[model samples]
Target chain A: MQVRCPHCASVFPSDRAGTQFCPRCGAQIHVPEEGQVVEAGLPPFAPGAPPEPSGAEGPGPGEGPTPALPPGVREPTPWERRRELGLFKAVVETWKASVLSPRRFWPSVRPEAPWTEALLYGWLIGAVTSIASIPLRVWQQRRSVDELREAAERLEELPARLRDILRPIVESAGAGTTGDVVAQAILGALLWPVGFIILAAVLHLCCLLVGASRGGFGATARAVGYAWGPMVILYLPFIGWLGWVYAAVLAAWGVKELHETTWERAVGAVVIPFVVVCCFACCLGMAGVGAAFSSLRASP
Target chain B: MHLHLPPRNRTFGFVDALGVTGAVGLAIARWVPVARIVPFWGCVLREQTGWPCLGCGLTRAADRFAHGDFIGALQANPLGAVAAAFFALCVVASALHLAFGVPLPEVRLSPREARGARWALVVAVVLNYAFVVVQTRFPHLLA
Candidate 1:
């Protein structure tokens, strides 16, 4: 039987009744007996689309039990309560919840919240992390150049063939200047949002491909944004990249909770894209090698 | 990946895995004479084509970077040197985080941004390959 979600006004085909999750909005819906079925002609929201405006009141109390904070209702993250908590506190609370207490935190993440809010949070974290890590990356690059130049001075003692081969490497060592590093750093900070958004899209696409994405793109975007909590490690020396792993795991958890999907599907949504990209890159690389071999043979 | 991190002291779960893998990798790189064992381990593309492949000098670059010969690593392959430094950084950072219980942050992106990152990576790879070609085939221009 077709039942309309009283909370979000989304209509979906349902065979079973009782306390069940709306595939579209993930709201806990209580379907009534066939005699009590009210055929409301409200325009249904698209499947996996953001919740409609709350102007439409749910069925009178007689219809069923209404959840206090309906899944269709937008539950604002701490970062969104900047006016009440102040900006710093909001950021801190949100980051803490996302990274440390994700099990409790992800369920609170509403798929209906404006995706831009999460996007802004991710942007702030990424920009800060990039700016903080610049010093370390710059130091590493500088050390690399200095070491190369020193080795070049001793190249004279090496065999002629080896020296000839090493000369180009030495020449290119100084290719990146301080100015260049600064420019790259600035670009990275500015482009943080773009990178994050793309990552979320890829993951969402994977979710869709695997038939796992129950929530709209907004949910996926929010998941990826909140996942930025782990990226703070970027500010520290060494283990910054581990933030990527942690963030990925957090995002997957968020998807499972917000989308109301299984762990296998949520994890698959994240892993499939990575596997596909790696396989594609390997093939592309092999093709390049093959082309190079053919060109070499043709030249002779 | 269904790898759950406990609510409270989450650092211990994966720290051991990272520590073991990193230690084993470093030990092999430091103690084992991999270069001697694989004497013919050179870039086949470079050997036949007179032009350097994207990964042509990566091994040499890694070896130099591992030995604290940053300059030699850069001279061999700038990308490879960067990668080696990044690997070392991850190992050390993971160890410290496990020891100190530092909090990690999560990161998320929108679809547009994800596409942009992929494009940016592609551009970086192409640019790096171009640099390798210029340095190898036309060294005078750089000089």
Candidate 2:
């Protein structure tokens, strides 16, 4: 039987009964059995439809009156104040829920959550991940030492001029000690707030450019901060890329939910910045290659 | 029964294209001696752990495989040659799918088969690393 997705309005055949997510857009859909009454008040499927006005503009069906906040004071969110459940427990729970079900989680979040709390969460996750990577970092340092020793042995066989030229470079590269690793971890944790602020600003600008800035800068910042929940898995080898992708997905979903914007707008806001960064990296890489070639050609 | 799902987003196609471009670039670099003159960015994992990670030496191994040194490629990392071949197939498959709307068959593996595949991959990685260790520590055995 053919089923029309209520979210994207894409029609696809579904043989199985009951609730299933639309493959096209990952929206939840429920298919009823024969003679069953279709759910009432469900939004009708409309292709390329503009998003409905949020409760902030007008009271939508079943939506309550929008809450008012005093100037310069942001209300604490449940996720931020779950101290009764213990701080670590609350953080882990929040991270798990946000990462696993971002669509549902983000929509439920109060727009008034302080950006500072979000930044702290992001920093804490970064610090935890860095600490988790200590064992791997130590092993890597040991391997580096062995390689340096081997290189030194080989360097002894080279001519005096060649040896003199390469020795200093090799020595500098092999200078990573355990103290360096600890310092890097501390620095990474401390600098995470800066990264979060920059990311939030970029995304907020993108949202404004895309005409989806409904909840203001604070809302966007909060969304960006909470969306970094997936960074908890940054210590995992090989699969760490998954954490980055998941974080991006969460950020897009969070933006959409908090702004009450369409999926297209949210995705555009998230992905445009990423595409720009990639293009910039590619250009820099090409410039570097050109410079190297020029230097190689100029050398005697 | 096979379930045919909806077509994925063009972003996935773009990502696949990038992967194909990189693999093809690396393959071409194998034949060009000038490419070999580029500075080596040694693996961070290998430098830290005193052992090669799963992806260590993949570029060089792929280059060797492209130059018809299958044994050397295997010695460098068996997983690298396999991954190169797999990715090469993916490039062709993705191109065909994108251009002609040809759908690739989705193989649904049984639990046993999935477990077996995972174990096989683990074995390949372990055996490859063991070979590397032996070659590095006791060169005369391989010689």
Among these predicted structures, which one has the highest TM-score?
A: 1
- Write candidate 2's Cα lDDT for B11-125 as tens digits: 2222243345445545574666533343334444454456654456666777877777877777777777776656567667657667676654433333344345446666887
Residue pairs in collision within model 2? A139-B48, A139-B49, A140-B48, A140-B49, A141-B48
- Model 2, residue B46: distance off in Å is 36
Quote the lDDT for B55 in model 1.
Answer: 72
| DockQ (0 to 1) for model 2 | 0.01
Q: Which stretch of 10 consecutive residues in model 1 chain B shows the poorest summed lDDT?
A: B1-10
Q: Show where candidate 1 strays beyond 4 Å.
A: A1-74, A151-173, A276-300, B1-143
Give the DockQ of candidate 1: 0.02
Q: Relative to the true structure, how large is the alpha-carbon lDDT of every model? A: 0.65, 0.62
Error of 1 at A219 (Å): 1.0
The model with the greatest DockQ is 1
TM-scores for all predictions:
0.48, 0.46
**TM-scores, chain A, per candidate:** 0.66, 0.64
